[model samples]
Target chain A: DKKKQLQQLDNFIEGVLQEALEEFKQVE
Target chain B: MEERIFGTECEYALFHQLPPPSAQGSGKTAKWSGTSFSENLQEMSHLLVCALRGQNRPLAGEFLANGGRFYIDRGSHPEYATPECRSVADVIAHEKAGDRLVQKLVEEAGGLMAEKDIPGRLHAFKNNHDPRGNTYGSHENYLVSPRAMEKIQQIIPFLITRQIFAGAGKIPHLAPPAFSGEDWLPFAVSQRADFVEHVLSDRASDARGIINTRKREITRSGDNVRLHVILGDSNMSEYALKLKIGTTALVLRMIEDGLGDIPAFLQPVQALKVISRRPAGVHAVEGAGSGHTALEVQSIYLEKALGYFSSHAATGEEKAVLCLWETTLSGLKNLRISPSGVIEDDPGELSRKLDWVIKAWLLNRAREKKNLDWSDPHIKHLDFRYHDLDPETGLFERCASLGLVDRVIEEEAILLAMEAPPHNTRARLRGGIIGEAWGKDVEVLVENWESIRIIAKSKVDGMHPFARQRRSVNGLKANLNDPFEGCNEALLKRVRRFLDKCDEV
Candidate 1:
């Protein structure tokens, strides 16, 4: 369960960063 | 006696793909492909860890350091989590240390990136949201007992309204297509508000709640409840950060004592978003089985806190927090009643203390100066620039230099905090071990906040977060559990002996 939670958090962070990076590229 | 320890975990993105100053000087803006940027960031993370290792900095579980931990988090962004702090002042100091450390890493890596012709200078922002409606976190962690965890629902009202003073103000941009024209606000009190979608949830990423329930406690002690708050804005103003944490601590104390008189908001998630969008207006939010404005709800908490302080002995820090809270509430009330929607009598006073006020003042002035509407892209850029970690270019630093914003922590304190842990709590012990291990060249394993193993000697267990103890193989034990103890000479001596024994073996 702990591993799953950590994995979820990792994925969430990656999603946020990926979306931001993509948006940043478009705007810049 | 055990004391509550507060800490912060700040996640920030590095824009390494942008053109470096050297590249821009050549009259060309160079950009790295996203793939290359990710690869180079991974390489830089390794180099950063190596650099810290070279300095003999004790690393825990590969990434955690003495003062804090640094690693490449998800999406290749670097995250820093400060060691446990005893006070809100310590929280601010350690958080600033992170900003400095990251800036140092960027500057150091800039040379290497230049050598590799990576083309872009890395920039980090401490703010919460990006321009594309995505938000990251500057999550606050507070150590509490299991008993205090029961009072979380009671504290939600206070959290919902605190953004009036605590929010790192953001310009509204890119309203969702589902929203009608009137739903688009000109500005918001919080940068993280629009992204919040839950009233209470264990999940942090998809449906982020005001108070997170992801149950990973850094301290192994069974008694502590780690209160992870993911709702707040990433504040640049020291005063805002201090008040935000300090006032919440005081309120938690009140709730634990059963002295809380908090109202229940009807739709807390919607109320949170509304409060951030319409900070100055008195909107009806159902609370206390009736309708109340955010200011009114905040006033109730402030009054209860004041009453609590009056009945019980309040510390100097608590007193200062109460004074600031009262002053901020008054400022909000005054702004609501004012015809001009500006504090003309002492515009600079609140601007110097509150994050949202300061930012709103700056944005309003810029809007007037540039003859641009609030929806201008440049306004959003200015908002992001307010949180730039660079002292030379960050708008908040410029405001501080101009005496438009106030600071609680001293510069020297922040610099000291970068290397040294807080004097109180188990962090000092952790930091001492790291320092000694580095000095003696003894290989040790740092597991977490509570456990450290001396290589081939013994495992030092600091089970109680507040209790500092030293145990040896020969049954020579010393107790230094008191949080107020300034020096850990006895423990340091024991650690040195253990390192020597390990080396001899």
Candidate 2:
């Protein structure tokens, strides 16, 4: 269960940066 | 005045599900390793058409015996458009018939794949958007008198708010964590709402609009313009489909009778998103006062419709719609959903009758049992399975088989709708010809909705002395331009003439 907690901490940062970068590129 | 013709087109997502490779624990995919599913989807669509056509050879455009069109749409979307219907019940029945027919074709495709030693199960989804940002359409076509366009603004608000009941409900497969928490809406009312980029646009692939301005088929005679609505979701709930079409038709009747003074949304796109994203929250409607709920806006249109029908000579269908509209409005007022992504109160059974509520109820229970998030894989799988066309496995079908959701039509009606066209419209004539000819070995080509081309299906060795006579009748095109044309004696005479010539040869 504590190992599950380790993965839970990463949900916010997961794929957000790549997704935002792709969206910004689309504006061009 | 003549009854208006109504039609519906549903673009389905065809895929074959394969278990993920044993080495990788990634989710299940509807693809082969070397080939993308999109490439296979095209072949799958052709296989479905061929199965229905039976050795008649695959033409990319083939009309079914039931007077409906089944063909590969813009992308890999296998589309089925219901025949023109004069009555609301006929539209619902025909649309349901389309689903049954599509499911049967999907089964046939699965069997064909199995025979060829393919590794997966083929499934078709009557849904709007995919895990990626791609969206297909579930479009509605209402034949309006030419002058009805001038008063179209009067109904935009009604169209925007109609999603409260009309929405097919979206729970994305790849929902990001941003929309996950209790404060943000985990579920959207309409899947197509956010994809509507314009108020009116001709482009359907991109710059999509609420009312697709592109004229799908050329309406030459009767001065009719088909009002093509692309915003609707492909409904699994029959009651939702009936209310959506029936209510919109009644309001169009009001507009045709020159009923004006209905308020236009100040920013329709903004209003559409707000109603879809926050169904229970206070809506910031532009001119008609802020803080009104989605139900209140629908009430405005419903009240006006009730008043108009009271004075006007409303049909039996119109009267039933008014009753349903009033009751549904009252029911919606009593229904409540909490911010924690759960249905708190649905006293009026709107959840059972509407798609969004039915889904929210199911999703809420699943979450409560396992304490799962909105983006959880289990919840997403349930959402996708709900719209699956398979009766044995689709969640909606299971709910329907269990008598959990409301059913508006009977099994017999849907079966009949599959084989026969609506008795009242030009489709009857078209369907009669298709069924009569296809029953024999005669090959017919449906060039478009309004035209049919027929040729004598024969063998080269079988060519006889009367080959010249067959040539006279071959490639004869019949144009049934009028949507109101009945299957009369004159049309039958011409069709019989062609069939007779082929027989003589």
Model 2: lDDT of residue B298: 87
lDDT accuracy of residue B475 in candidate 1: 23
TM-score for all models, in order of appearance: 0.82, 0.86
B1-505 per-residue lDDT for model 2 (tens digits): 2388899999988756654456323432334542123547777787787677653522324676678888788877888899989888999999999899889988887778767666667778888976555789999999888777777777787888899888988764344455444434678889898889888889888988888888667455567889999889999999999999999998888888877676666677877876777776555555667556677778888888878877878888888888988888888888777776688888889878999888888777666756777766556656766788897657677667667789888989999998888887778888878866755546787878887767777542233323344455344567879887866777677677667656655
Alpha carbon deviation, residue B145, candidate 1 (Å)? 2.5
- Measured with DockQ on alpha carbons, how good is candidate 2? 0.03
DockQ of each two-chain model: 0.04, 0.03
lDDT of 1 by residue, B316-404 (tens): 88888899888878876665312222335543367778777777676665656556565655565566767777665566766666555
List ranges where model 1 is wrong by over 4 Å: A1-28, B20-66, B176-185, B220-222, B281-290, B336-348, B456-491
| CA deviation > 4 Å runs, candidate 2 | A1-28, B23-31, B34-39, B55-61, B172-184, B282-286, B289-291, B439-441, B457-475
